[model samples]
Target: MKSKLPLFFFLILSMFFSACSVNSHIMFKTKKNEVIVDNIPISPADAYRLAPDDKIAFTVFVENGKRIIDISSGVNENSAGNQQINKTDNIQYLVRNDGQVELPLLGLVKVGGLSIIEVQEKLSQLYSANYIDPFVQVKVTNRRVIVFPGTGGDAKVIPINNNNTTLMEAIALAGGITERGKANIIKVMRQTTEGRKVYQIDLSTINGLKYADMIVQSNDYIYVEPSRQLTREILKETTPIISLISSAIVIISVILTLN
Candidate 1:
């Protein structure tokens, strides 16, 4: 009975947390999931577009087989010198605004928003004047994104090259979901000078595109909330239950004898 007194308290506490638990996944849905819920009211992805200050890497290959690479696209003058040194086959490039990259032979060419294949073709066409059948491969290198999951949970930072980064890729970077992590109703808090905007990303109904492995963008912040596991697991065998129960019984018997 003395031991169960602690068990009784534990059960009561667990119930308290369960009562407070909220099903937030249904509350916040990704733009895609929301539209599906409400009969496809609008296309949300259309609103998402890349902007400046976005980190990207660029790679350039010349006809004679000189590969020029530039990372940290925003401001990397060093890349020019590095380009002159490396004449190998692999060159990674970061996209520069004014929508172009600096090539040794073809100064600057517009490359923003173009797919990798399109960029390669554009570069080949520009370089063909001097070299025959140029081999060009373009990729984005600094696709770095930071995820800050506050209140709900922890934060994580992720980086990418050219390709779109997904959601799960960000989570795995933070050591996977914690015992306290919530899978369904996680909230995404996005920050900007216009003030922070809170968006709901429901993992449960996010069809096709998986959230955990979802690709992230440059400077993007992500948050994962603590699941009720935190509250429930608290004081739950944080100490050995057998030892705790034995101590409680001894103490109770001593008090009974003294009385």
Candidate 2:
């Protein structure tokens, strides 16, 4: 019996393991396009806007290289612009009360709601008034990402160096989402002087790819939640005893079929 018992146990063990592999564990009915239902969809990029508290750096072209060279030499140090990069050839400003940033030579100008490119062009036109052929370059220095609470998010703020960050990009940076993360349900919360606005985004559909053009701004929070299917699947895999039984069943089946 002992000798035969080993064979029996082996067969049973293999079968048990195989059972687990087949339908024992991680078994749940998911809708069609399981991956889509399971994952966060990306949105399309129509336009990227700006908000307050966003820090920006601007550089005005010094045609004769005198202003550029002078500023680059560290003569007049700008607090905001100096914090931006290595030299004073640039102007740094945060979006203030009137959605404007005060510049050294250019004074205050409203920059919110305008894209970086637009800002550069506008600055060029504005600076051209003072400097000849002023070539302007503007960059968003401090980009803030928002994560919502109660969903797959935490009430936290993430800072980004580049302004061109997207929804997915933001999520990936924040340790991705938890297992219970609801990918399909993501919200990009924004605050404006008028009021607080919420841009609901679907990170799990093709349509989301269209809206994903949501360029993350400074102090904006993005909240992610878990989908039902993903939550269920996660719960199933976490069962220790069930997984053990499944493993045993698989081992038995392997032995029986091979024998």
Candidate 3:
């Protein structure tokens, strides 16, 4: 029985090494010498276009925002009345699946695939028939992105309030990458007209500054690959098994001595 113990321990160790991977917690892994797509062109001019199911805060002003300034400055007693009306109008409008949003004057206008500026212009044109010098404002109230900053339980859904929020800005909003994260292995997964496009970004050097300014769109996923700690991970995975084996060995020794 004592001679068989060596074989038993060897079998257990073999199973442990085969079953557990030291870097199992790491995600979005790439193969060695794998071709990563990183040539996606990006610039500040590339604004975030409105998509279906997006909620927007739509507002229209007359006399080129004269009423807006009056209401803001409290110019007269009429400001109170305007303020009341503004409160009633300050509500979110949903863009339907067919890329149309129902507005006050315009029943169902196509706003999807258009930038916020474009939507405002389109709405202003449609409302021009009814109002004088109509000024339109459209804001996507639910624009956000998911970011995994290379640490477990450290992911965040960051809201994009700015029109040109960059990749670096989004990371900053998510508290930047954790110490265990690899700066050179950042991935940006974006949904394009063709399909889902994955872009690899390397921000570890000065040359990577260009990608730092890459504007992020709504619902994009940013993942930072984590550095693998082989020794620590192996110990963590094997501690319980080793403890159990040690306990069993003590029990077996006591039984053999009693015998």
Candidate 4:
């Protein structure tokens, strides 16, 4: 009988080469759309509102009719303003589920749906009710954005130090997206007063620069969708195992024939 070894080897080689060629074609076809990315105009980010589990710190100042630049001179009359709390002292207040934050003397104050500036104003008004004048400056301590790089990778929570973190910076921090990740189809999900919003970004063309400039917000989800060729690549990865199994079977058959 004609040897089956040659035919078996030929089939394996052909399948491998065919898979490689198809994968290459898919890569080119999918990337062609990416290069044609059009500019997407995005509006400015709305003021970030307070949410549960957010840590906020505020510094309260009580004006003492001072006119000096330095306000740390033992609360003197010449000082700009007296520090209600210690300069180094800061209360890391956590927003509760009830949309309220406990303060030293203000008790449970509703802070949900309020921006940092709004909270500062509200606290100033609250403290003014008791004291002469309360100057409050509030800021969020922990701000972060979540990133999902796709390709079966785990999600990553990246901290936003500047609050103005761009799309590219966020992806870079998450290890710059996987090879199977389609950058042009990236999605940024945000929670707004109207409801949840999703923004699509394309990074392959210069026109995508505007979208990339969109500032990242806390609790935002950045997802990089995997390429359509993912299935082909996965199937290609299994080819080696199939080839090994077939080679082993061929060797065993030859040994039996010789015996």
Candidate 5:
């Protein structure tokens, strides 16, 4: 029995190492030789374009928003303008799968693929037929991204209130990366027209500052890889086995004593 004890413990240890994966919680792994995409251009020139299913709050005013800023608001001659404002203000309008949104009088207007400013210009031109020098304000109300800040139970769904929210901004909003996070192995997964595109960002050096400013889009996933603590993880995985072995030893000793 004494000789068999060493062999039994060896077999259990082997099984534990073989069956359990270390750093299993680490996600968005890439091949060691796989080429990762570089920093995407994120500037005013490459602003986020509207996409399907994006909810927007739209508002329009005549005379270049004269009434909106007017301290003593005068009654407008065009009751239709007031009606249109009432129909859209503070109400969410969904962009359909076909890239169109249902608007008053305008019917279904194509808004997908256009930026907020572009949409505003397009709507202003369309509403020009009814209102004089129409001013349009468009805001995307439901732009958000998911962030995993390098630790379990630290993932957050962050809203993209700013149209030009950067990767670093999103991380900061999620309370920054945990102490166990690997800043050099951050991954940003974005859904593109072709398919899902994964981009690796290294923020450990000043040279990586360019990638840090990469603008985040709606539904984007930012995963910060957590550093592997081999000793701690191995101990955690072996705790149950240790407890079982201890219980078995106690039982064996009790049976022998009774005999």
Candidate 6:
């Protein structure tokens, strides 16, 4: 039995190395000059344009004595001195097929190819034309990105509440990566006018945070790859069962020979 000790050790060592040497696909490798230095300003990317079936919210800003009110009052008084339900209670402006939403004062405003900031500026201008010192705030209420955490985890849609939700933020909002997830390998898939664009990001290193800090776009697909550690753990768990089965087979052979 002791004579097999060297063979057992060799097999174990081979398996360990094999598990460790599993090919892992990492993303966003640091460039030659990609060093983490201070005073590096990160400019935010452009805002998302409104699409069909997208929901938007328009808030009228009012300034008072040292205080500002966001007219999101959530309630609207009717002309008949009765309280009427406001369908825009949540400030959701449903974008119609014609790429326009009818506002209270401004009718059929075109907002298809415009960003949230651009829409806000346009709304502010429209409001100022009619109302006194109108300050309009426009936003896309239902902006979201889908996250695909590989390894059989449930895919989730992460709402982009802020216009500048980053890759790390999306991961965090989706309850972070799973135990089988590889932090070093992350892909962000975004749709462009020409075609779909994919961006790879590695978060295993401190410098990789630059890529991880990249802004996520609406309807973006984020995928986190599986980790090799999970495969190693599975192999480690099955090794004992395999050894037990082999021992049982050897015992049965000995018993049969004795019978």
- For model 6, residues 1-259, the per-residue Cα lDDT tens digits are 9966875786677666655645434333334344233332233344568878888876565331122233444232333322222333355768898898877767788998788788888887877764556566676778899886755446699898886678888888888888777777676766666466556666878988777667788898888877556566647755875687579769988999999
In model 5, which range of ten residues has the least summed lDDT? 68-77
Would you estimate the TM-scores of all the predictions? 0.46, 0.51, 0.79, 0.67, 0.78, 0.59
Which residue pairs clash in candidate 3? none
Over 4 Å off, model 3: 5-21, 31-38, 44-47, 63-89
Comparing 4 and 6 on TM-score, the stronger one: 4
187 Cα displacement, candidate 2 (Å):
3.4
| Deviation in Å, model 3, residue 8 alpha carbon | 4.8
lDDT of 2 by residue, 1-259 (tens): 7756875675566655544554222222343432232233233232345567777776554563234422234343233444434553244578886788877666788887887788888887886766666666677776666664334324466777665677667777776766656667666655555454555556566866765655675666676644446434444544565566569779988999999
Per-residue lDDT for 128-184 in model 3, tens only?
Answer: 887668787778899999999989789999998886899999999999999999999
The clash count for each model shown is 26, 46, 0, 0, 0, 1
| lDDT measured at residue 36 in model 1 versus the true structure, 0 to 100 | 24
* Cα error of candidate 1 at position 140, Å: 1.0
Q: How much does each candidate deviate from the true structure in C-alpha RMSD?
A: 9.9, 12.7, 4.4, 7.0, 4.7, 8.0
Best-matching candidate per TM-score: 3
What is the per-residue lDDT of model 1 for residues 1-259, given as tens digits with 9 covering 90 to 100?
A: 8957877787566555644544433223346433222221112232233333333333444543443333223222233466443432244444566666656656766666565577667777876775545556544545566654433345556665435446666666666666555666455554444544454556655562444454454555666655444433444434355466569879989999999
The RMSD (Cα, Å) of candidate 3 is 4.4
Looking at model 4, report the run of 10 residues with the lowest lDDT sum: 65-74
The C-alpha lDDT values of all candidates are 0.51, 0.59, 0.79, 0.71, 0.79, 0.67
Off by over 4 Å in 2: 1-46, 64-85, 89-91, 149-153, 189-220, 226-259
Q: Write the per-residue lDDT of candidate 5 for residues 68-177, one digit (tens) a residue.
A: 31111334534345654554556788999999998776789999888889999998999898777988888999999999998979999999988779999999999999
